[model samples]
Each structure stands twice: as structure tokens, then as C-alpha cells.
Target: MTAKVALVTGATQGLGLALVEGLAARMSTEDTVYLTGRDAGRVAQAVEALPAGGARVRGEVLDVAGPHEAGRLAERLAERHGGVDIVFGNAVMRVGPEDDPREIVGAYAEVNNFGTTRLLRAFAPLLRDGGRFLVVASSFGTLNHLAPALHGRFDGLSSLDEVDKQVAVWRDAVADGSARGGDWPGFVNIPSKIGQVAAVRALAGERREADLARDILLAAVCPGMMNTPTSAMWWDVRDAPSPAQAAEVLLDLVFRPVDPAQYGGLVRDGEVLPWR
Candidate 1:
């Protein structure tokens, strides 16, 4: 019997590395897991750092966000096992230095949103009939908490929704209007308290191949602001979970009964979040 193989991207440190460890712990006797990163050295480090008695794990170098790298990974996997059984898109970029509201719109969208689109495009087809797809996202994607309370009024006017409608209502409030200094409203109240997590939701909403491809497990997990070098101020954040704990909580989902084929679209904090 051929062993099931799993590929985890950005398996260097933080949530990615922790997940690699946890998955290794759960691998069956005839299973293999591969950890991948952009750099060869980092991949080596990830392989060496595998849990003491985890599965027979190995590491490879592949930047999932790049065409060349993803292609090479596809080639290697096809040659080795014909296709992969699982893919953990557990890589992301949070806010920039000091969580600058200024960079939130562009930088975060570029890395967190579009980058994911590119990676999924590259690897979704390589998944075997029963492969799982897990994407590491943030709690920010919830979009349910965009309260009018947080985002303050612009030019002395309140209501965050108004700003959102600025493009439609005011006709160019973004270009020639009082919405100038307040470029990114996140500074005032961070309306998108859950947009990052919502990105996973959005992708699942738009395209739910992971769940549909096979009897596969598909999830979008919020690792919970764990103590990771993800951001310099991780330690300062109020009680943060350990990467190991996050990993454990994430994997525990596999056992809990949920239709992998039905709700394979999204997962939040281990539960499948609404894609509606």
C-alpha cells in the first residue's frame, strides 16, 4: 500500500512549523509528510526540528507563492507519489511594523489576499481525490464585527459604513475629499477586526475545491494570536497561545465529526465557520 503524503508550505517557524510537528505526530504507519520553505537552509532546519518520534518526515525548498517553485514542487510530488494527499496553505503576512494602519490596505492585501490566490491556483489541482487543504488565516476575516462603534467619523462625521460607501455615495471620497489624512480607517477603529480570517472565508466562498475535490478535510484556521515571531510585538500581546497548543487544537478538528465534503470550505478556531 502506498503511503499518504502531505505538503505544508512555509513550514519554517511559527504556526507553520508547529503544524508540521502536529501533523507528523498523527501520521499513520504508512504515511509521509514534507515540510517546505523558500530557502534550503530553513527547510533543513524544519526537518531537523521535527518532533522527537514523529513520522518519517523530510523537508524540501519551495516558495508556494512563486510559479517556478510551485511547479518544481508539483514535479517532485508527481514523481514521488503521483500526487499529494494533503496541502496546508499555512503561510501568511500580518500587519507591518507597529501594525501601521497606513500599510494595512496595500501590504496586507497583497500578501494575505492575492498571494493566497496565486498559491491555490498553483497547487489545488495537484491534490489527490481525498486530499485535505488547510489555509492559515487570521481572526480578522470574520467581517461580522465591523461595528460603527470602532471606526470614528471622518471630517467630524461618524459611521464607518459611510466611509465604505464613500466611493459610491460621495463619488471619489478616496481621491479628492476629506478622506485624505484618514487613508486607512483601521487606525481610528480598525473596522476589519476579522477581515483577515474572512479572506479564507472569501476564498472558500468563491472556490471550495478542497472540500469538493475528495472526502478531504478543508479548513481555514485562526491560530489565535500565538507567541510567534509573526510580529515583533507578539510577546506584548495579551495572553498568547503557544504554537504547539495552536497546532494541537487545529489537528483535533480532524477527529470531531463534521462533513469534510459538506463544510470543507472553512474552519475557524477548529470549527467550520459560515461561508454564507
Candidate 2:
């Protein structure tokens, strides 16, 4: 049997790096895992530091926000390994309350929303049958934080068109300053995550037929609060789990058997959580 191929994005540090290490440790001799980040130097350092194993661990520079880069990576993976068996979309960007609203919104959408979509579009074709796609998501993205109407629209999404429409609404709100209004709550990171969660739901619904035919499973998971640099910027990290602990939970999901019933849902602490 051919060995499995796994890829983790934004894996130079924090939770992403820990995830790469966990995945690498679990791989068989024939398997290959690719660890990617935007910084070549960081990627090289990470690759060198990971524990050596029979499974080949390689590092590459990849910015998930770049569509061209995503496409190229997918193409290269196809050429070398036939297709990918698992993908962990872990790259993200966060902005503080003091930052300019426009910059915050743009960064969130570019890195979290569009970036996730681009990876899905580019790599969906390359995901082999019975493969898994996991997006690192957050509880902040849940419908509970969104306005009732916006929440309804997101919850009602059953296709990619609906998902696109919902994202456009948020984008428009951001442009018009309405996202900062009573209904939308103008936090820099939440809206971006909201868009990501909605897209995952829509993609799961839209791809249901294809997923069934191809045996592909798609899911979004929140690693809970982790004591990472990004989290330190906002919350007190003293109470949170270390990145390595969070990585263990994430890797568990990656290796578990696919369950059709859980498709398109948000998972936290190993259990499926209701989006609303």
C-alpha cells in the first residue's frame, strides 16, 4: 500500500509547529509530511529541529493567503505524491483593537477567509478519496457572536453561493462601517472567523455529493485557548494549555476514522459542538 501524504500550513511556530511535530511523530516510514510557512528561514529551522523518523519530513515556504502559491503547491504535490491524504489549514492572522479597522478587516479576510477558500479550491482536487481536510477555526466564529439575522443567514447556508453571499454581506458591512455597529460587533478576529466557519459549513453542504462519491471529509476545529504568542496579545495565557497539548487534540482528529455525521461541524476538545 502507498504511504499517506499529509500537509500542514503555517507550521513554523505556535500551534501550527506543534501540530507538525505531532503528525511527524505518528507517521510511518513510507509516509511523508510537509511543513509549510511563509518564512523560509523559520521553515528550515523547524524542519531541522523536528525529531527524525523513517517518515520523510520536509519544509517549504508557503503563504496561504496567496492563491498562486496554493495552486502551485497543489500541483507539485500531485506530481510527486499523486495526491494528498490529509491537509491541516492552520495559517491565520490576527489584529488588535488598537489597529486601524480597515487594516484589521483586510488582514482577517485575506488570511483567514480568502486564504481558507483558496486552499480548498486549489487542493480539493488533489485530496485523494477518503481524505480529510481540517481547518483551524475558533469559537469566536460561532453564530452565538453574530447578530440574529446574520446568524440566520449563516445557519441557513446550504450551498457555496449562499456562503459567498454571506461573506459579501460581512465584507460590505466592514466597508460601510456597519460591522462595527450594534448588529455586527466590530472585533477584528471574530468576523474573519465567522466567515471561515460559514464557508466550511457551505462547502460541506455543497460538496456532500462529491464527498460521498470521493469519501472526503471536511471539518473545522477550534484548539481552545492555547498559550501562544498570538493568544498572549489578547488574553492571559497562563491558564491555557500549551501549544503541544492543543496539537495532541488536533492530531487526534486528523488520524481518527472519518464519520459522515460529523461533516461540516465545529469541533472542540474532541467533541462536535453546535455552531449556533
Candidate 3:
């Protein structure tokens, strides 16, 4: 039997590294898992630290936000593995309240939102039938974070184009100082995650037929409050779960059978939550 292939982005530390290790622990001699990070040295170090045993663990330098890198990585994976069996979209950027609003919003959107779309576009063709694409999202991404009007706009989105349009609206609001005027939260992270969930829903809906035909599944998941550098930098993580615990939840979903009803939905604590 051929070994399955898996890819995890931002695998240098925190949840990403934990997930890579957890997945590696479950693999057989034939399996291969790729660990990606912006820093080549870090990626190499991470790969070396994994106890993959007989399974092959490789490192790739990747900046998910880069325009050309995603495509290049996808092509390389295709040539090396024929196609990927699973993708864990875990790379993200966190912005604090004190940061410049415009820069935060732009950087978050580019990394968390557009970068995800770019990965999906580049890797979709390389995803074999019955493959899984999981986006690590957050509870804060729930539309309740926005005003009713904005909530409706985001919740009612039915396509990737609409999601892009909604993101553009938020970008415009940030640029014009309207995002601070009671209606918007003035924080970039929440909206960026909301865009991720929205994009998952839209992509799933648009690809429903293909998904069924190919047995492909897509989902957004919240790993809960973990004690990671990103969380520590922005909020209190004194009581948060360790990255290993969160990685277990993610790995459980990855190994379990796909549930069509939960496709394109948000999951937390191992339970699927309503998209709205």
C-alpha cells in the first residue's frame, strides 16, 4: 500500500509543530509528512525534532503570504507525491490593538484570508479524491462579532467572490476610519478569521458537486485557546490549553471519517458548530 502524504503550514512552533508531531506519530513507514515555515533553518530543525520513526518527514521553506511561493510549493508537492491526502492550513498572523489599523488589517487579510485562498487554488488540483482540507480558524470568527448589518452581509455570502467583496468592504472601512465608528470592531484578526470561515463555506458550496463526486471535504476548525506565542502576544493565556492538547483535537478530525453535514462548517472542542 502507498503511504499517505500530509502537509502542515507554519510547522516551526506552537500548534503547527504539535500537529506535525502528532500526525507523524500515527504514520507508518510508507507515509511522508511535510513541515513548512518561512525560515529554512527552523523548518529543518522541526523536521529533525520529529520522532517519525520509519516514516519520512521533510522540510520546506514556505511563506504562505507570498504570491509565487504557494504555487511553486504546490507544484513541487505534485511532482514529489503525485497528490496530497490532507492539508492543514495553520499559518496565520496576529495583530494587537495598539498596532496601526491599516497595516494590521492589510497584513492580516493578505496572510490569513488571501493566503488561504491562494493555497486552496494552488493545491485543489493536487488534492486526491476523498482528500481533506482543514483551515485552523477561531471562535472569534463567529459573525456575532460584527453588527447585525455586517453580520447579515457576511452570513449571507454564497460564493468566494462575495467573500472577497465583503473583505474588500472591511478593508475600505478600515482605510476610511469607518471601522472604528461603532459598526466595526476595529480589530483585524477577527474579521480576517471570519473571512476564512466565509471562504470555506463559499468554496464548499461552489464545489459541492465536485466534492461529492470526488469525496473531498473542507472544514474550518478552532483549536480553542492555546498557550502559543501568538495568543500570548495579544491576550491572556495563563489558563489556556497546551499546544499538544489542541493538536490532538485536530489530529482526531484528520483521522476520522468525514461527515458531509459538517462540511464547510466550523468545529471546536471536537463538535461542529453552526456557521451563523
Candidate 4:
């Protein structure tokens, strides 16, 4: 097998950090690893903190939402190593507590959706036939929204229309059909049709990061909920796993590709969790 270089964004903490550790544990020395984040200090710290691995670990400063970072990053790859083999688009902006549902909607679109689109556009040239591109999205982006599972309080989803409304009823436990949460529905289109259903079955938000990095065959791996600062907003789950353990899950996916259908993109409990 041909060895290659990988560039992972948001590698300072949480799930992003896991991707760093996992790749380090899995890749051989001939391969190169670049840990990135907007904060240069975090990047430097993460590089110093990496565990012993066959791959060489370096740090870079990158911002997923801003312009030029992607193109500039690609240029760096070209300068130092000639090309980049993998691009893990994991940089994300955090949301603060707010009542406005629209704010949450806008945040996800700009940060999660548009950010990925931008990076892909800038780095399209760097990715060769066998290069990999992974986006660390949430179940929120999928057809099901994983809304009912654990997104009860995520305001961005509260005002969605159509299909999302149907889900709210079952989740909110309405009394006397009075609609405990609201009179209107937040609509999102997941499981609305055959194609959507297929996508739901195929949505591998987190697992792809650790999988095979080839030309266009990108993969993802979900870190599930972890005990990092990212989970500061949600309080229901107790003592989520550490970034190190989460990294192990991703490493498993890299060394062994778990069928997306079987894993549902969120690998946990030594197996992939089934999407409802």
C-alpha cells in the first residue's frame, strides 16, 4: 500500500484531537501528519503532546470558515511535501446559549455546511485520484437529525419546518394535543423519501475521518458525545468518554473500515450504533 500525508484540522481538543491521536497510532513513519487549528499556540501544543507513532507530526494554523486558509494550506503542503494525501475538515465554531432558533440554524449552515464547501473548493487540486476528504459533521446534518435522540434543547432545530415538526410531537410528549413546545413546527427533510432514507443509512459524519484516504473515497467517524468543552452546552449525558478513547475508536476505523450501514457513522461500544 502507498503511504501518504494527512492534514487534520481542529486538532487541539475534543473529537478533533482524537483524529490526531488515532492517525498517529495508525499511520506509518513514511506518512506525515499535520495537526491544525486557528490558534497557533494550540497547534504547537498539540504537536508537542502527540504520542509516539510511525508518522511525523507537525502543527499548522488554519481557520475553516475564512478564505485562503484552505488554498494557503494546500500551498504549504505543496512546498514542504509536494502534495497532501488527506484533508480532514474538522474546524468548527461553537454556539453560545441563546433563545433564537434562527441563530442556531444560521450557525450550523455557515460553520458546518458552508465551511466544508469552501475547503473542498480550495483544495480540489491538491486531492489526487486516491486522496481522501473527511468532514466531521453531526447527526444534526443527517435526515433523522438525531434530534429525538439527544437534541431536545438545541434551539437551532426547534423552528425547523415540515418533517422536523412531526418528530417534535413524538419527542415533546404533548398533552391534550396542546403542543407543549409551540404551535408551529420546525421542518427538516430527512427520511422524507427513498433517496433521503438511503442517505440516512449512509450518513457517516464522524467515521470518515479515520477511514481509507484515497482519491475521492472519503470516510467519516463520529466521536459520539465526549467529556470535552464542546459538550458544555448539553447536560443530560454523564461523564462522556475522553478524547484519547475517542481517538482509539477512530483509529480502529482507519485500520479497519467498519461498514457504514453497520456503524451508522457513530461507532461506539466496540461496535457501530444503529440509527433509529
Candidate 5:
């Protein structure tokens, strides 16, 4: 049997762990799913707790927020498996209401935007034909939240470099207090989320012509408000679906035949959101 490989980042807890569980349950003995986290002990525990039967579960130490971690993992996976079938950019940084919005933009950019972009840059080439790359993102990732000019600027970007440049522009505005008066969104999370989605769009556009023949798919997916520990920190999730439930939804996209409609879009509950 040809071995199938999947990688889920930040899989030690919450939604990431649930995605790992969902993937493991669907894969056969010949397949493998790598569950990664920053801490070795937690990664091991998460792998051990998975019920036996589906895919072979393995633990890996990974921190997407770290400078060189994503690139290293891509290299290691390429050397060992030649390529990967699924790549989940599930790692994230949570911001609480009390945290100063301006003060946290830099941190959020590092993890939420740059980290995810780095993952795309590294793992995109390693995605096998018909493979999928999906980022666990937010519905707030739409460009409609920005001022018309800003919205147009982001929507017009054709490369990841342009997205990075725009994010730097926002960061500079925040540092100088211009963001307060400028038409920027007050919350740091909005722009960070937008940057993530925009990067996905940019990369997808870059590979569109080539990827069509290969049947590869890539998108930024919103798992909705799941009743996970991370979400409970920021909002009330009493009625939200459990992480496992959300994972099932994500896995549907992961396993389904590629849909041209969803490619490079901000997907939520099986629909591509309008950018405007």
C-alpha cells in the first residue's frame, strides 16, 4: 500500500488535537499522521492518547511561531516521505479582550500571519499531486472590515510579498499612533486574519495555472466558533460545536474531491465568503 502522510501543527490540545484525532480515525494502518506541538512531552502525550486502529500516529516537535521551525519540518518530511498529502496550518495565537490591541499586533503578526505564510512557502512545494493545504482561519478574515482604500489594496495583491508589505505598513501605522486616526480596524486580530487569508489567495493565484493539472487545493478555512479551550478564553462558546465536530467538518473538505469554487477563498461552513 502507498503510505499516506498528514501533518497537523499545534496538535497537542484543543482544535488542533481534535483535527489530529479526526484524521487518525479516517486513515488506515499504512497511513501516518504527524501531530506536532512546541513541547515534546505534550506532543508525545497527545499521540499516546489517540485510540489505536486508524493511521499510525507520530509525535513531532514544532513551533510555527519559531523562525526556522516550519522550514525544518518541511525539509525533514521531504527527506523521509518524499511529500505529504495533507498539511494543516492549525497553529495560532489567541488574544484576550484585556490585551492591548496595539501592543499585540506585532505578536499576532509573527504567529498568525508570518508564521502561516512561512508554512505555505515551505510546504507548498512538498504537497503531492492532489494534495491539500488549509489554514485554520477566521470568518473575520474578509477584507470588508477595512477602509475602502485598504480593502482595495489587499484585494489587489498578487503575491505574498505584497501582503507582507501591507502588513508591515499596518504595523508601522499602529506603532506611530496613526492607526487610531487612520481608517484601520481597532482590533489587531482583524488585519492579522486578513493577512493570513490574503497570503493564501496570493499563493493560490501564483500556482493556479500549474496546480490545475496537479489537482491540488489550498484555502483558508474558518472552523466557526468551536467550544474549545482557546475559544472559551475569548468568548462564550456554550452553544458552539465541539472541536471534534468542527474537525469533522474540516476533514470533509480535506477528504473531498477538490472544489474549484473554494480554492483560495475564506471558507466557512462549506461556503466561500465574499471578500467585499
Candidate 6:
């Protein structure tokens, strides 16, 4: 494979670490793979845990939701590597049942929703010709989560602004305590997941409109159910595959050349799921 520069956010553990490990094995020695997390020690440990490989694995301290960090990392990458070939937006906050709903609202709003927006804004331009940006999203993010009455509101979503409007509506509902019994999905994470997928679609459109010579492929991918710490927090994991197993599946898809039909879609197990 050609020397490529890749970045995977929240790579200290679980699926994120699995992705980094997979990439490290496939990449050439000249290639660079950056694994990032908010914690420096954990990031270092994750890098150290990787098996010996040709790829140059580096750890970066990055809080995707924190202000200006993604942009700064983008600048550094631009200066050092000219641009990046692959980006995996995998950082997320998974809320638990014991957590206070009010206290956790900002995490879902900022990390899951706007954190994705921030990653796209900072890294989209840095994608080299034929580069790919894949968001680690869930099937739950699909438009099927929306009520029938609200489906029309998201139709023909063509801009980030439109996605933001949808997020704002969810936020408003939450603030008013109407989200539970109203048109919105009861789970706070649902709207943010929807926002992530919608944002990826909108950004893909914007990239096409720019008409750049680069064929930058962008999409959201669901890695299916994994028996990771994060997954075990919410659901039964006995039937789920190990993080390494799911990573193998996901990396297989990532390494393949994606056709236009796959772009901007929510992919799972090599197939694009129905958005509507």
C-alpha cells in the first residue's frame, strides 16, 4: 500500500483501539497513524499495546469536543504531512442509566453531535485525493428513528445548517421535558446519532459541490454490536462479537475501494442500510 497518513479519534480502547491496531498492520512503515484520546497516559499505553508493524503509530492528546483542539491538530497535520489520507471520527460519549439526564445533555449535544461537526470542519479540507472520512456511527442513527410526522422535516437534507436545526429542535424539546412523551425519540442519544449521520450526508454533498479534483469519500459506518466495555454499558454482549472481530470486518470494508453508491450512506456489514 502507498504511504498514507491516518487518524482515529478516541483510540485508547475498545473499537477505536481495534481500528488503530488494524491500520497499523496494513500500513507501510512510511505511513503514519495517529491514535488520539483525551488522556495522555492512556493514549501512550494504547500505542505501546500495538503489535510491531511497518506503520508509524503515534499518540495524540485530543478532546474532540473541546474547543479549538481539532482545528489545531488539523493545522499540525497540514504542516507535517501536507494532508491526511484517512480519518475515522470515532470519539463519543455513551451515557449510562445511572447518569443524570440533565448533566449528560451537553455531552450528547456537544460530543456526539457538534463534536462530529467539528471533526468534519477541521479535517474535511485536509483529506487528500481519494481520501476517506468514515464516522463510527450506529444503525440507530438512521432516519427510521424519527416519527412519521417528523420524517418530512429531514427530507432532502442538503446542509449542515439544516442538521443543526434538527438538533436544536431536540434540544428545545429536552429543555421543556417534552422529549419523553412527545414526537422525539425518548433516548437522548438517538437525536445525536441522527445528527451525526445527517451531518455526514450534508458534508458529502458539500464536498461534491466544491468540485475538487480529489475524490474524497465520506460516510457513516455501523460496526455492528461489539462486546466492548462501551457496548456492555447499555446492552447484553453475550451475542455480540469481540471488538477485534468487528474491527476486522470494518477494516475489510475500509480498505476496499468504495463505489459512489456507498458514499454518504450508513453502512453496516458491507451493505448500506435504509435511511428512511
By lDDT, the best candidate is: 5
lDDT of each: 0.57, 0.81, 0.82, 0.54, 0.87, 0.84
Candidate 4 ranges beyond 4 A from true positions? 1-3, 99-108, 128-130, 146-216, 257-276
lDDT of 5 by residue, 178-246 (tens): 999989888887888888899999999999877767888899999898887667878899999998888
- Of 4 and 6, which scores higher on TM-score? 6
Query: TM-score: which candidate is best?
Result: 5
Worst 10 residues of 2 by lDDT: 97-106
Report clashes for each candidate as comma-separated counts: 12, 0, 0, 23, 0, 0
The digit string of per-residue lDDT tens for model 1 on 1-276 reads 668888787788877787778788887757788888878998897788666664668888876445366667777788888878777776555554466444344444334444454555556667676666666765544433334542232222222233233212222332244444444343212323233333334445444554555555555665667766554443475466777877877676644554644343346565555532
- Alpha-carbon runs more than 4 Å astray in model 6: 209-213
Measured against the true structure, the TM-scores of the candidates, in listed sequence, are 0.71, 0.92, 0.93, 0.64, 0.95, 0.93
For candidate 5, give the lDDT of residue 7.
Answer: 94
Between prediction 1 and prediction 2, the one with superior lDDT is 2
What value does the lDDT take at residue 276 in candidate 1? Answer: 27
Those runs of model 1 whose alpha carbons end farther than 4 Å from true positions after fitting are 94-110, 145-184, 187-213, 231-235, 255-265, 274-276
Candidate 4: minimum summed lDDT over ten consecutive residues — where? 188-197
Worst 10 residues of 3 by lDDT: 48-57
TM-score for candidate 1, residues paired by index: 0.71
lDDT of 1 at 4: 81
Candidates sorted by lDDT, best first: 5, 6, 3, 2, 1, 4
Candidate 2 TM-score, C-alpha based: 0.92
What's the CA error at residue 123 for candidate 3, in Å? Answer: 1.4
lDDT of 4 by residue, 133-236 (tens): 55554443433454454333322331123223433343333223333344323432121221122222233233244332431434433556667664666454
Q: State the displacement of the C-alpha of residue 186, model 2, in Å, after optimal TM-score superposition.
A: 1.9
lDDT of 3 by residue, 120-152 (tens): 778766888778888999887788776677787
